[model samples]
Target: MRRRRLPATALAVLALVTAGGCASSPPPPPPQTRAGHPERGAQLIAQYGCGSCHTIPGIDRADGLVGPPLTRFGARSYIAGKLPNSDDNLRRWISDPQAVVPGNAMPNLGIDQIDAQDIAAYLYTLD
Candidate 1:
């Protein structure tokens, strides 16, 4: 029989993980971004039913477990942990997830560039 003592930092991280669950408490309504309209993007997210899969902050009824929660999307350096999180890359991913990663869970949703830009803008506000 053996028991290993977890480091304090590791225990703290574990506590945060267990406590936070998926996302932080709902954030204030999203603000605007330089690339596109965040408000419109929020609307588009609702219209597209993106909340059906992801736990997006500030989006009502966005409590889903099928996909990763976008708690601090703007702070993330990568999109889907692959593509760099640049505006162009984000827009590309939003437009067609399969094209970028080939087997990602996020579907294309037939979103155009304009809408993709707005969605990206809104996502960036999650930080």
Candidate 2:
């Protein structure tokens, strides 16, 4: 018996369909306590020079590249690959990252409780 061959276009379409069938969507981002106050956090971030090590969002003047950016912190699964992502955790990280991660590059900025809370609040809104 003789076999027939599909046209090039038909074969291409089939390949695309097969590849698309195997595609999967990414997981959802982590939840936050409340909407972020990026504006307020922005101010604190600049005042504390957080941009020197870590990157934060909405602060155009920030150019530091030592640490990760705070653009999508609210949705991140972990703060330093060990600590869970949450309002409380974020506050802890902002105030003292070394304590949570141990030997982490982040330093203790001596951020007050209220300022840390505000920073966490702002980070949570990145999503």
TM-score of 2: 0.68
Q: What's the TM-score of each model vs. the native?
A: 0.73, 0.68
Q: Residues 1-127, candidate 1, lDDT per residue (tens digit)? A: 8999999999999998778654345333333435999999999999999999999999999877998999999877677867667888889999999998898788879999999999988999888
Tell me the lDDT of model 1 at 25: 51
- Top TM-score prediction, candidate number: 1
What local lDDT score does residue 52 receive in model 2, on the 0 to 100 scale?
79
Clashing pairs in 1: none
Model 1: lowest-lDDT 10 consecutive positions: 24-33
TM-score of 1: 0.73
Q: Write the per-residue lDDT of candidate 2 for residues 28-51, one digit (tens) a residue.
A: 446624544656877888889877
